[model samples]
Target: MIRHLVLFKLNDGVRRDDPRVVEGVAAFRALGDLIPELRFWECEWNISDRPVAYDFAINSAVEDTDALKRYLEHPAHTAGVALWREFATWVIADYPF
Candidate 1:
Protein backbone atom coordinates (compact mmCIF):
# COMPACT_ATOMS: atom_id res chain seq x y z
CA MET A 1 0.00 0.00 0.00
CA ILE A 2 1.05 3.56 -0.56
CA ARG A 3 -0.12 7.02 0.41
CA HIS A 4 0.31 9.97 -1.89
CA LEU A 5 -0.22 13.43 -0.43
CA VAL A 6 0.09 16.83 -2.01
CA LEU A 7 -0.45 20.48 -1.07
CA PHE A 8 -0.84 23.40 -3.41
CA LYS A 9 -0.59 27.20 -3.26
CA LEU A 10 -2.14 29.19 -6.04
CA ASN A 11 -0.31 31.94 -7.85
CA ASP A 12 -0.72 35.49 -6.70
CA GLY A 13 -4.08 36.74 -8.16
CA VAL A 14 -5.60 33.29 -8.41
CA ARG A 15 -8.46 32.62 -6.02
CA ARG A 16 -10.81 29.83 -5.01
CA ASP A 17 -13.41 31.20 -7.42
CA ASP A 18 -11.28 30.50 -10.49
CA PRO A 19 -12.88 27.94 -12.79
CA ARG A 20 -9.58 26.23 -13.43
CA VAL A 21 -9.06 25.75 -9.71
CA VAL A 22 -12.55 24.36 -9.33
CA GLU A 23 -12.10 21.94 -12.23
CA GLY A 24 -8.71 20.79 -11.02
CA VAL A 25 -10.11 20.12 -7.57
CA ALA A 26 -13.04 18.17 -8.95
CA ALA A 27 -10.75 16.13 -11.16
CA PHE A 28 -8.62 15.13 -8.19
CA ARG A 29 -11.65 14.07 -6.19
CA ALA A 30 -12.76 11.80 -9.00
CA LEU A 31 -9.45 9.92 -9.17
CA GLY A 32 -10.62 6.99 -7.10
CA ASP A 33 -13.41 6.38 -9.59
CA LEU A 34 -11.34 7.18 -12.65
CA ILE A 35 -8.17 5.26 -11.72
CA PRO A 36 -8.41 1.68 -10.58
CA GLU A 37 -5.25 1.85 -8.54
CA LEU A 38 -6.50 4.77 -6.48
CA ARG A 39 -8.21 3.17 -3.55
CA PHE A 40 -9.12 6.32 -1.67
CA TRP A 41 -9.11 10.05 -2.27
CA GLU A 42 -9.72 13.13 -0.14
CA CYS A 43 -9.08 16.83 -0.37
CA GLU A 44 -9.23 19.91 1.86
CA TRP A 45 -9.24 23.60 1.20
CA ASN A 46 -6.94 25.59 3.44
CA ILE A 47 -8.33 28.92 4.49
CA SER A 48 -5.29 30.09 6.39
CA ASP A 49 -2.65 32.74 6.31
CA ARG A 50 0.21 30.44 5.39
CA PRO A 51 2.10 29.31 2.36
CA VAL A 52 0.68 25.80 2.66
CA ALA A 53 -2.68 25.85 0.90
CA TYR A 54 -5.12 23.18 -0.27
CA ASP A 55 -4.29 19.53 0.37
CA PHE A 56 -5.07 16.28 -1.44
CA ALA A 57 -4.34 12.74 -0.44
CA ILE A 58 -4.62 9.39 -2.17
CA ASN A 59 -4.36 5.95 -0.67
CA SER A 60 -3.50 3.08 -2.98
CA ALA A 61 -4.09 -0.26 -1.32
CA VAL A 62 -3.60 -2.45 -4.40
CA GLU A 63 -0.90 -0.60 -6.27
CA ASP A 64 2.86 -0.77 -6.11
CA THR A 65 5.38 2.00 -6.68
CA ASP A 66 5.32 1.23 -10.38
CA ALA A 67 1.58 1.74 -10.52
CA LEU A 68 1.96 5.07 -8.78
CA LYS A 69 4.59 5.98 -11.33
CA ARG A 70 2.16 5.13 -14.08
CA TYR A 71 -0.57 7.19 -12.43
CA LEU A 72 1.72 10.20 -12.41
CA GLU A 73 2.12 9.85 -16.16
CA HIS A 74 -1.54 9.09 -16.81
CA PRO A 75 -3.63 11.40 -18.96
CA ALA A 76 -5.77 12.54 -16.06
CA HIS A 77 -2.70 13.44 -14.09
CA THR A 78 -1.15 15.10 -17.13
CA ALA A 79 -4.18 17.36 -17.33
CA GLY A 80 -3.73 18.22 -13.69
CA VAL A 81 -0.11 19.10 -14.27
CA ALA A 82 -1.03 21.39 -17.13
CA LEU A 83 -3.66 23.13 -15.04
CA TRP A 84 -1.63 23.29 -11.86
CA ARG A 85 1.36 24.84 -13.60
CA GLU A 86 -0.20 28.21 -12.98
CA PHE A 87 -0.08 27.62 -9.23
CA ALA A 88 2.76 29.15 -7.29
CA THR A 89 3.84 26.17 -5.22
CA TRP A 90 3.22 22.49 -4.70
CA VAL A 91 4.30 20.07 -2.01
CA ILE A 92 4.11 16.32 -2.39
CA ALA A 93 4.89 13.27 -0.30
CA ASP A 94 4.63 9.56 -1.03
CA TYR A 95 5.24 6.70 1.35
CA PRO A 96 4.66 2.99 1.54
CA PHE A 97 1.89 1.81 3.81
Candidate 2:
Protein backbone atom coordinates (compact mmCIF):
# COMPACT_ATOMS: atom_id res chain seq x y z
CA MET A 1 0.00 0.00 0.00
CA ILE A 2 1.04 3.56 -0.50
CA ARG A 3 0.74 6.01 2.34
CA HIS A 4 0.18 9.52 1.13
CA LEU A 5 0.56 12.37 3.57
CA VAL A 6 0.15 16.11 3.17
CA LEU A 7 0.64 19.17 5.33
CA PHE A 8 -1.02 22.49 4.51
CA LYS A 9 -0.16 25.97 5.64
CA LEU A 10 -2.73 28.67 5.15
CA ASN A 11 -1.54 31.85 3.52
CA ASP A 12 -0.90 34.82 5.72
CA GLY A 13 -4.08 36.51 6.97
CA VAL A 14 -6.17 33.47 6.12
CA ARG A 15 -8.23 32.19 9.02
CA ARG A 16 -9.54 28.72 9.61
CA ASP A 17 -13.11 29.92 9.83
CA ASP A 18 -13.00 31.67 6.49
CA PRO A 19 -15.76 30.47 4.20
CA ARG A 20 -13.38 29.42 1.45
CA VAL A 21 -11.28 27.43 3.87
CA VAL A 22 -14.36 25.76 5.30
CA GLU A 23 -15.48 24.70 1.85
CA GLY A 24 -12.04 23.46 0.93
CA VAL A 25 -11.88 21.43 4.11
CA ALA A 26 -15.25 19.87 3.46
CA ALA A 27 -14.36 19.12 -0.12
CA PHE A 28 -11.21 17.26 0.89
CA ARG A 29 -13.00 15.51 3.73
CA ALA A 30 -15.47 14.09 1.26
CA LEU A 31 -12.95 12.59 -1.13
CA GLY A 32 -12.62 9.31 0.72
CA ASP A 33 -16.25 8.49 -0.05
CA LEU A 34 -16.12 9.88 -3.57
CA ILE A 35 -13.03 8.07 -4.83
CA PRO A 36 -12.92 4.32 -5.25
CA GLU A 37 -9.14 4.11 -5.41
CA LEU A 38 -8.77 5.38 -1.86
CA ARG A 39 -8.43 2.59 0.64
CA PHE A 40 -8.25 5.00 3.57
CA TRP A 41 -8.47 8.73 4.24
CA GLU A 42 -8.06 11.12 7.11
CA CYS A 43 -8.24 14.90 6.83
CA GLU A 44 -8.16 17.31 9.73
CA TRP A 45 -7.48 20.82 10.85
CA ASN A 46 -4.50 21.27 13.14
CA ILE A 47 -5.10 22.19 16.76
CA SER A 48 -1.57 23.24 17.55
CA ASP A 49 -0.60 26.87 17.48
CA ARG A 50 3.14 26.25 17.25
CA PRO A 51 5.01 28.23 14.61
CA VAL A 52 6.20 25.05 12.95
CA ALA A 53 2.77 23.48 12.69
CA TYR A 54 0.79 23.33 9.49
CA ASP A 55 -2.83 24.44 9.48
CA PHE A 56 -4.23 21.22 8.08
CA ALA A 57 -3.19 17.69 7.20
CA ILE A 58 -4.22 14.73 5.09
CA ASN A 59 -3.27 11.12 5.67
CA SER A 60 -4.40 8.61 3.11
CA ALA A 61 -3.65 5.20 1.70
CA VAL A 62 -4.14 3.39 -1.59
CA GLU A 63 -3.29 0.01 -3.02
CA ASP A 64 -0.38 1.22 -5.13
CA THR A 65 1.01 4.00 -7.27
CA ASP A 66 -1.65 3.47 -9.96
CA ALA A 67 -4.45 3.84 -7.47
CA LEU A 68 -2.72 6.85 -5.96
CA LYS A 69 -2.59 8.43 -9.42
CA ARG A 70 -6.28 7.75 -9.95
CA TYR A 71 -7.09 9.35 -6.62
CA LEU A 72 -5.03 12.44 -7.46
CA GLU A 73 -6.58 12.78 -10.91
CA HIS A 74 -10.18 12.43 -9.81
CA PRO A 75 -12.31 15.51 -10.43
CA ALA A 76 -13.23 15.94 -6.82
CA HIS A 77 -9.62 15.82 -5.76
CA THR A 78 -8.61 18.34 -8.41
CA ALA A 79 -11.37 20.67 -7.38
CA GLY A 80 -10.30 20.49 -3.79
CA VAL A 81 -6.72 21.28 -4.76
CA ALA A 82 -7.85 24.26 -6.80
CA LEU A 83 -9.84 25.63 -3.91
CA TRP A 84 -6.97 25.15 -1.53
CA ARG A 85 -4.51 26.79 -3.88
CA GLU A 86 -6.33 30.05 -3.38
CA PHE A 87 -5.53 30.17 0.32
CA ALA A 88 -2.75 27.74 1.16
CA THR A 89 0.51 26.10 0.20
CA TRP A 90 1.30 22.48 1.01
CA VAL A 91 3.86 19.69 1.05
CA ILE A 92 3.32 16.00 0.45
CA ALA A 93 5.06 12.66 0.71
CA ASP A 94 4.23 9.14 -0.42
CA TYR A 95 5.82 5.90 0.69
CA PRO A 96 5.07 2.20 0.40
CA PHE A 97 4.27 -0.06 3.31
Candidate 3:
Protein backbone atom coordinates (compact mmCIF):
# COMPACT_ATOMS: atom_id res chain seq x y z
CA MET A 1 0.00 0.00 0.00
CA ILE A 2 1.02 3.60 -0.48
CA ARG A 3 -0.12 6.70 1.25
CA HIS A 4 -0.42 10.07 -0.45
CA LEU A 5 -0.68 13.19 1.67
CA VAL A 6 -1.22 16.74 0.53
CA LEU A 7 -1.34 20.03 2.41
CA PHE A 8 -2.45 23.35 1.05
CA LYS A 9 -1.39 26.77 2.23
CA LEU A 10 -4.07 29.10 1.08
CA ASN A 11 -3.60 32.58 -0.35
CA ASP A 12 -4.20 35.89 1.34
CA GLY A 13 -7.78 36.69 2.34
CA VAL A 14 -8.97 33.25 1.39
CA ARG A 15 -11.68 31.63 3.50
CA ARG A 16 -13.05 28.13 3.74
CA ASP A 17 -16.27 29.12 2.02
CA ASP A 18 -14.52 30.64 -0.99
CA PRO A 19 -15.34 28.98 -4.28
CA ARG A 20 -11.76 27.88 -4.70
CA VAL A 21 -11.81 26.09 -1.36
CA VAL A 22 -15.10 24.40 -2.15
CA GLU A 23 -13.83 23.25 -5.53
CA GLY A 24 -10.58 21.92 -4.09
CA VAL A 25 -12.41 19.71 -1.63
CA ALA A 26 -14.77 18.47 -4.31
CA ALA A 27 -11.91 17.71 -6.67
CA PHE A 28 -10.07 15.61 -4.14
CA ARG A 29 -13.23 13.66 -3.34
CA ALA A 30 -13.89 13.10 -7.03
CA LEU A 31 -10.38 11.76 -7.64
CA GLY A 32 -11.34 8.28 -6.44
CA ASP A 33 -13.55 7.84 -9.48
CA LEU A 34 -10.88 8.79 -12.00
CA ILE A 35 -8.08 6.95 -10.18
CA PRO A 36 -9.33 3.50 -9.44
CA GLU A 37 -6.47 2.59 -7.15
CA LEU A 38 -7.46 5.08 -4.54
CA ARG A 39 -8.23 2.80 -1.65
CA PHE A 40 -9.19 5.50 0.82
CA TRP A 41 -9.33 9.29 1.01
CA GLU A 42 -10.01 12.11 3.41
CA CYS A 43 -9.99 15.87 3.09
CA GLU A 44 -10.38 18.43 5.87
CA TRP A 45 -10.90 22.13 5.97
CA ASN A 46 -8.92 23.69 8.77
CA ILE A 47 -11.31 25.30 11.17
CA SER A 48 -9.48 25.24 14.44
CA ASP A 49 -6.51 27.22 15.74
CA ARG A 50 -6.73 29.33 12.61
CA PRO A 51 -3.26 28.61 11.36
CA VAL A 52 -1.34 31.45 9.85
CA ALA A 53 -0.60 29.60 6.63
CA TYR A 54 -2.70 26.67 5.39
CA ASP A 55 -6.41 26.32 5.08
CA PHE A 56 -6.82 22.61 4.45
CA ALA A 57 -5.13 19.22 4.27
CA ILE A 58 -5.86 15.99 2.39
CA ASN A 59 -4.68 12.47 3.13
CA SER A 60 -5.14 9.49 0.85
CA ALA A 61 -4.24 5.85 0.58
CA VAL A 62 -3.64 3.94 -2.64
CA GLU A 63 -2.94 0.36 -3.59
CA ASP A 64 0.69 1.04 -4.55
CA THR A 65 3.28 3.51 -5.71
CA ASP A 66 2.08 3.17 -9.28
CA ALA A 67 -1.38 4.07 -8.17
CA LEU A 68 -0.04 7.11 -6.38
CA LYS A 69 1.81 8.19 -9.51
CA ARG A 70 -1.23 7.79 -11.68
CA TYR A 71 -3.32 9.79 -9.25
CA LEU A 72 -0.71 12.51 -9.21
CA GLU A 73 -0.73 12.80 -12.99
CA HIS A 74 -4.39 12.22 -13.64
CA PRO A 75 -6.13 14.76 -15.87
CA ALA A 76 -8.67 15.46 -13.16
CA HIS A 77 -5.83 16.43 -10.87
CA THR A 78 -4.39 18.66 -13.57
CA ALA A 79 -7.75 20.32 -13.97
CA GLY A 80 -8.01 20.88 -10.23
CA VAL A 81 -4.55 22.36 -10.21
CA ALA A 82 -5.47 24.78 -12.94
CA LEU A 83 -8.56 25.73 -10.99
CA TRP A 84 -6.82 26.45 -7.69
CA ARG A 85 -3.27 27.24 -8.80
CA GLU A 86 -3.55 30.94 -8.25
CA PHE A 87 -4.79 30.61 -4.68
CA ALA A 88 -2.93 27.68 -3.23
CA THR A 89 0.44 26.25 -2.37
CA TRP A 90 0.56 22.48 -2.04
CA VAL A 91 2.84 19.68 -0.91
CA ILE A 92 2.58 15.95 -1.56
CA ALA A 93 4.22 12.81 -0.28
CA ASP A 94 4.11 9.14 -1.15
CA TYR A 95 5.03 6.40 1.30
CA PRO A 96 5.02 2.66 0.91
CA PHE A 97 3.70 0.23 3.45
Candidate 4:
Protein backbone atom coordinates (compact mmCIF):
# COMPACT_ATOMS: atom_id res chain seq x y z
CA MET A 1 0.00 0.00 0.00
CA ILE A 2 1.05 3.56 -0.48
CA ARG A 3 0.76 5.94 2.40
CA HIS A 4 0.12 9.45 1.22
CA LEU A 5 0.75 12.12 3.80
CA VAL A 6 0.43 15.87 3.48
CA LEU A 7 1.03 18.82 5.73
CA PHE A 8 -0.67 22.10 5.01
CA LYS A 9 0.17 25.57 6.25
CA LEU A 10 -2.42 28.24 5.95
CA ASN A 11 -1.42 31.51 4.38
CA ASP A 12 -0.60 34.25 6.85
CA GLY A 13 -3.67 35.93 8.28
CA VAL A 14 -5.90 33.06 7.26
CA ARG A 15 -7.67 31.66 10.28
CA ARG A 16 -8.99 28.11 10.49
CA ASP A 17 -12.46 29.46 11.14
CA ASP A 18 -12.43 31.56 8.01
CA PRO A 19 -15.23 30.54 5.69
CA ARG A 20 -12.86 29.50 2.96
CA VAL A 21 -10.74 27.40 5.28
CA VAL A 22 -13.80 25.75 6.77
CA GLU A 23 -15.05 24.87 3.32
CA GLY A 24 -11.66 23.59 2.30
CA VAL A 25 -11.57 21.33 5.34
CA ALA A 26 -14.98 19.97 4.49
CA ALA A 27 -13.94 19.38 0.91
CA PHE A 28 -11.03 17.21 1.95
CA ARG A 29 -13.13 15.43 4.54
CA ALA A 30 -15.51 14.36 1.84
CA LEU A 31 -12.92 12.99 -0.56
CA GLY A 32 -12.81 9.40 0.65
CA ASP A 33 -16.46 8.89 -0.15
CA LEU A 34 -16.07 10.48 -3.54
CA ILE A 35 -13.03 8.53 -4.70
CA PRO A 36 -12.90 4.76 -4.64
CA GLU A 37 -9.16 4.72 -5.12
CA LEU A 38 -8.82 6.12 -1.65
CA ARG A 39 -8.62 3.07 0.55
CA PHE A 40 -8.31 5.22 3.64
CA TRP A 41 -8.51 8.93 4.43
CA GLU A 42 -8.16 11.09 7.48
CA CYS A 43 -7.65 14.83 7.78
CA GLU A 44 -7.42 17.03 10.83
CA TRP A 45 -6.62 20.48 12.09
CA ASN A 46 -3.33 20.83 13.93
CA ILE A 47 -3.55 21.53 17.62
CA SER A 48 0.09 22.12 18.36
CA ASP A 49 1.70 25.54 18.38
CA ARG A 50 5.22 24.25 17.76
CA PRO A 51 7.29 26.20 15.28
CA VAL A 52 7.41 23.29 12.86
CA ALA A 53 3.72 22.50 13.06
CA TYR A 54 1.56 22.89 10.01
CA ASP A 55 -2.06 24.06 10.19
CA PHE A 56 -3.57 20.79 9.00
CA ALA A 57 -2.71 17.31 7.84
CA ILE A 58 -4.01 14.58 5.56
CA ASN A 59 -3.16 10.93 6.05
CA SER A 60 -4.35 8.56 3.38
CA ALA A 61 -3.63 5.20 1.86
CA VAL A 62 -4.14 3.51 -1.51
CA GLU A 63 -3.39 0.12 -3.01
CA ASP A 64 -0.42 1.30 -5.03
CA THR A 65 1.03 4.10 -7.11
CA ASP A 66 -1.65 3.74 -9.75
CA ALA A 67 -4.45 4.07 -7.23
CA LEU A 68 -2.61 6.97 -5.67
CA LYS A 69 -2.49 8.65 -9.06
CA ARG A 70 -6.20 8.12 -9.53
CA TYR A 71 -6.91 9.65 -6.14
CA LEU A 72 -4.73 12.62 -6.96
CA GLU A 73 -6.45 13.14 -10.30
CA HIS A 74 -10.00 12.80 -9.06
CA PRO A 75 -12.08 15.89 -9.73
CA ALA A 76 -13.00 16.25 -6.06
CA HIS A 77 -9.36 16.07 -5.10
CA THR A 78 -8.39 18.64 -7.73
CA ALA A 79 -11.12 20.95 -6.61
CA GLY A 80 -9.94 20.65 -3.02
CA VAL A 81 -6.42 21.45 -4.09
CA ALA A 82 -7.61 24.48 -6.02
CA LEU A 83 -9.52 25.79 -3.02
CA TRP A 84 -6.53 25.22 -0.78
CA ARG A 85 -4.28 27.01 -3.28
CA GLU A 86 -6.12 30.18 -2.47
CA PHE A 87 -5.23 30.03 1.23
CA ALA A 88 -2.52 27.51 1.89
CA THR A 89 0.64 25.79 0.76
CA TRP A 90 1.36 22.10 1.30
CA VAL A 91 4.07 19.50 1.25
CA ILE A 92 3.57 15.76 0.71
CA ALA A 93 5.25 12.41 0.85
CA ASP A 94 4.21 9.00 -0.39
CA TYR A 95 5.86 5.80 0.70
CA PRO A 96 5.15 2.12 0.55
CA PHE A 97 5.09 -0.17 3.51
Candidate 5:
Protein backbone atom coordinates (compact mmCIF):
# COMPACT_ATOMS: atom_id res chain seq x y z
CA MET A 1 0.00 0.00 0.00
CA ILE A 2 0.98 3.59 -0.37
CA ARG A 3 0.19 6.39 2.01
CA HIS A 4 -0.55 9.79 0.57
CA LEU A 5 -0.23 12.55 3.11
CA VAL A 6 -0.86 16.23 2.61
CA LEU A 7 -0.60 19.23 4.92
CA PHE A 8 -2.08 22.59 3.97
CA LYS A 9 -1.43 26.08 5.14
CA LEU A 10 -3.97 28.74 4.33
CA ASN A 11 -2.72 31.72 2.39
CA ASP A 12 -2.21 34.99 4.20
CA GLY A 13 -5.46 36.57 5.39
CA VAL A 14 -7.56 33.67 4.22
CA ARG A 15 -9.97 32.46 6.87
CA ARG A 16 -11.46 29.00 7.16
CA ASP A 17 -14.92 30.45 6.84
CA ASP A 18 -14.25 32.09 3.53
CA PRO A 19 -16.73 30.91 0.91
CA ARG A 20 -13.97 29.50 -1.25
CA VAL A 21 -12.34 27.64 1.61
CA VAL A 22 -15.68 26.23 2.70
CA GLU A 23 -16.27 24.89 -0.79
CA GLY A 24 -12.75 23.51 -1.06
CA VAL A 25 -13.10 21.64 2.22
CA ALA A 26 -16.40 20.16 1.12
CA ALA A 27 -14.88 19.07 -2.19
CA PHE A 28 -12.08 17.23 -0.40
CA ARG A 29 -14.47 15.70 2.10
CA ALA A 30 -16.46 14.13 -0.70
CA LEU A 31 -13.47 12.64 -2.51
CA GLY A 32 -13.49 9.35 -0.65
CA ASP A 33 -16.91 8.64 -2.07
CA LEU A 34 -15.94 9.88 -5.51
CA ILE A 35 -12.66 8.08 -6.00
CA PRO A 36 -12.53 4.32 -6.01
CA GLU A 37 -8.76 4.08 -5.79
CA LEU A 38 -8.65 5.36 -2.26
CA ARG A 39 -8.45 2.63 0.35
CA PHE A 40 -8.47 5.16 3.18
CA TRP A 41 -9.26 8.79 3.66
CA GLU A 42 -9.18 11.17 6.60
CA CYS A 43 -9.23 14.92 6.28
CA GLU A 44 -9.63 17.61 8.90
CA TRP A 45 -8.61 20.92 10.29
CA ASN A 46 -5.53 20.93 12.47
CA ILE A 47 -6.16 21.01 16.19
CA SER A 48 -2.70 22.18 17.14
CA ASP A 49 -2.04 25.74 18.15
CA ARG A 50 1.68 25.52 17.57
CA PRO A 51 3.27 28.15 15.34
CA VAL A 52 4.61 25.58 12.90
CA ALA A 53 1.38 23.66 12.40
CA TYR A 54 -0.38 23.45 9.09
CA ASP A 55 -4.02 24.49 8.93
CA PHE A 56 -5.42 21.34 7.37
CA ALA A 57 -4.44 17.78 6.58
CA ILE A 58 -5.34 14.86 4.36
CA ASN A 59 -4.23 11.33 5.18
CA SER A 60 -5.14 8.71 2.64
CA ALA A 61 -3.94 5.45 1.18
CA VAL A 62 -4.15 3.54 -2.06
CA GLU A 63 -3.14 0.06 -3.18
CA ASP A 64 0.09 1.16 -4.80
CA THR A 65 1.85 3.76 -6.96
CA ASP A 66 -0.48 3.28 -9.91
CA ALA A 67 -3.51 3.70 -7.69
CA LEU A 68 -1.96 6.79 -6.21
CA LYS A 69 -1.45 8.23 -9.70
CA ARG A 70 -5.07 7.57 -10.57
CA TYR A 71 -6.18 9.33 -7.42
CA LEU A 72 -4.00 12.33 -8.20
CA GLU A 73 -5.38 12.66 -11.71
CA HIS A 74 -8.99 11.98 -10.85
CA PRO A 75 -11.38 14.73 -11.84
CA ALA A 76 -12.71 15.28 -8.35
CA HIS A 77 -9.21 15.57 -6.99
CA THR A 78 -8.17 17.98 -9.70
CA ALA A 79 -11.23 20.11 -9.12
CA GLY A 80 -10.59 20.28 -5.41
CA VAL A 81 -6.98 21.30 -6.08
CA ALA A 82 -8.10 24.09 -8.38
CA LEU A 83 -10.31 25.52 -5.68
CA TRP A 84 -7.61 25.30 -3.06
CA ARG A 85 -5.06 26.92 -5.34
CA GLU A 86 -6.63 30.27 -4.66
CA PHE A 87 -6.43 29.98 -0.90
CA ALA A 88 -3.66 27.71 0.26
CA THR A 89 -0.27 26.15 -0.21
CA TRP A 90 0.44 22.54 0.65
CA VAL A 91 3.05 19.83 0.92
CA ILE A 92 2.62 16.15 0.21
CA ALA A 93 4.45 12.91 0.88
CA ASP A 94 3.82 9.46 -0.52
CA TYR A 95 5.46 6.23 0.59
CA PRO A 96 4.95 2.52 0.54
CA PHE A 97 3.82 0.68 3.62
Candidate 6:
Protein backbone atom coordinates (compact mmCIF):
# COMPACT_ATOMS: atom_id res chain seq x y z
CA MET A 1 0.00 0.00 0.00
CA ILE A 2 1.01 3.58 -0.47
CA ARG A 3 0.30 6.25 2.08
CA HIS A 4 -0.42 9.81 1.06
CA LEU A 5 -0.28 12.63 3.56
CA VAL A 6 -0.75 16.35 3.14
CA LEU A 7 -0.60 19.20 5.63
CA PHE A 8 -1.92 22.64 4.83
CA LYS A 9 -1.21 26.01 6.33
CA LEU A 10 -3.83 28.64 5.73
CA ASN A 11 -2.89 31.94 4.11
CA ASP A 12 -2.20 34.81 6.44
CA GLY A 13 -5.73 36.12 6.49
CA VAL A 14 -7.66 32.96 5.89
CA ARG A 15 -9.69 31.40 8.67
CA ARG A 16 -11.18 27.92 9.01
CA ASP A 17 -14.69 29.36 9.14
CA ASP A 18 -14.40 31.20 5.83
CA PRO A 19 -17.09 30.06 3.42
CA ARG A 20 -14.62 29.25 0.67
CA VAL A 21 -12.52 27.19 3.04
CA VAL A 22 -15.62 25.35 4.22
CA GLU A 23 -16.43 24.47 0.63
CA GLY A 24 -12.86 23.42 -0.02
CA VAL A 25 -12.92 21.15 3.02
CA ALA A 26 -16.18 19.65 1.84
CA ALA A 27 -14.69 19.02 -1.56
CA PHE A 28 -11.72 17.14 -0.10
CA ARG A 29 -13.98 15.30 2.31
CA ALA A 30 -15.94 13.96 -0.65
CA LEU A 31 -12.91 12.63 -2.53
CA GLY A 32 -12.78 9.17 -0.97
CA ASP A 33 -16.30 8.38 -2.14
CA LEU A 34 -15.77 9.92 -5.53
CA ILE A 35 -12.58 8.00 -6.25
CA PRO A 36 -12.35 4.24 -6.21
CA GLU A 37 -8.62 3.95 -5.63
CA LEU A 38 -8.73 5.13 -2.08
CA ARG A 39 -8.30 2.36 0.44
CA PHE A 40 -8.18 4.68 3.43
CA TRP A 41 -8.97 8.29 4.05
CA GLU A 42 -9.08 10.82 6.84
CA CYS A 43 -9.11 14.60 6.97
CA GLU A 44 -9.22 16.94 9.92
CA TRP A 45 -8.52 20.40 11.15
CA ASN A 46 -5.41 20.62 13.29
CA ILE A 47 -5.98 21.19 16.98
CA SER A 48 -2.46 22.38 17.64
CA ASP A 49 -1.66 25.97 18.40
CA ARG A 50 2.09 25.46 18.08
CA PRO A 51 4.10 27.70 15.77
CA VAL A 52 5.02 24.94 13.34
CA ALA A 53 1.74 23.09 13.07
CA TYR A 54 -0.22 23.12 9.86
CA ASP A 55 -3.89 24.09 10.01
CA PHE A 56 -5.33 21.12 8.15
CA ALA A 57 -4.32 17.62 7.20
CA ILE A 58 -5.27 14.72 4.92
CA ASN A 59 -4.17 11.16 5.54
CA SER A 60 -4.99 8.56 2.91
CA ALA A 61 -3.82 5.39 1.25
CA VAL A 62 -4.00 3.77 -2.16
CA GLU A 63 -2.97 0.41 -3.58
CA ASP A 64 0.20 1.46 -5.37
CA THR A 65 1.94 4.13 -7.38
CA ASP A 66 -0.54 3.76 -10.22
CA ALA A 67 -3.44 4.12 -7.85
CA LEU A 68 -1.74 7.08 -6.27
CA LYS A 69 -1.37 8.70 -9.68
CA ARG A 70 -5.03 8.17 -10.44
CA TYR A 71 -6.06 9.72 -7.14
CA LEU A 72 -3.85 12.74 -7.71
CA GLU A 73 -5.12 13.27 -11.23
CA HIS A 74 -8.75 12.61 -10.49
CA PRO A 75 -10.96 15.52 -11.47
CA ALA A 76 -12.57 15.79 -8.07
CA HIS A 77 -9.15 15.97 -6.45
CA THR A 78 -7.93 18.51 -8.93
CA ALA A 79 -10.94 20.68 -8.26
CA GLY A 80 -10.42 20.42 -4.54
CA VAL A 81 -6.76 21.31 -4.99
CA ALA A 82 -7.70 24.32 -7.03
CA LEU A 83 -10.00 25.50 -4.30
CA TRP A 84 -7.44 25.04 -1.59
CA ARG A 85 -4.71 26.57 -3.74
CA GLU A 86 -6.37 29.90 -3.36
CA PHE A 87 -6.19 29.84 0.42
CA ALA A 88 -3.37 27.64 1.61
CA THR A 89 0.13 26.35 1.11
CA TRP A 90 0.85 22.71 1.83
CA VAL A 91 3.42 19.99 2.14
CA ILE A 92 3.02 16.31 1.22
CA ALA A 93 4.60 12.96 1.80
CA ASP A 94 3.91 9.72 -0.05
CA TYR A 95 5.51 6.38 0.61
CA PRO A 96 5.08 2.69 0.24
CA PHE A 97 4.12 0.87 3.40
Best by lDDT: 5
Clash pairs (backbone) in predicted model 6:
none
| Candidate 4 residue lDDT tens string, 23-71 | 9999999998999998889999989999999999999999999999989
Model 2 agreement with the true structure over 15-70: per-residue lDDT tens digits? 99999999999999999899999999999988999989999999999999999999
- TM-score of candidate 6 against the unseen true structure: 0.98
Please report, in order, the local distance difference test score of every candidate based on alpha carbons: 0.70, 0.97, 0.78, 0.95, 0.98, 0.97
Cα lDDT tens digits, model 6, 1-97, are 9999999999999999999899999999999899999999999999999999999999999999999999999999999999999999999999999
- On residues 42-61, what C-alpha lDDT tens digit does candidate 5 reach at each position? 99999998999999999999
Score residue 73 of candidate 3 by CA lDDT.
84
Q: Distance from true position, residue 84, model 3, in Å? A: 2.1
TM-score of each: 0.79, 0.98, 0.82, 0.98, 0.99, 0.98
Q: Candidate 1's C-alpha lDDT?
A: 0.70
Clashing pairs in 1: none
Candidate 3, superposed: residue stretches over 4 Å from native: 50-53
Backbone clash count for every predicted candidate, in the order shown: 0, 0, 0, 0, 0, 0
Q: What is the Cα-based lDDT of residue 1 in candidate 4?
A: 100
Q: List runs of model 6 lying over 4 Å from the truth.
A: none
RMSD of 4: 0.6
Instruction: Itemize residue pairs with steric clashes in candidate 2.
Output: none
Q: What's the CA error at residue 22 for candidate 5, in Å?
A: 0.2
**lDDT (10s digit) by residue, model 1, range 1-97:** 7788777777778887788888877777666677776766666676566554453333344367887887887888777777777653687888887
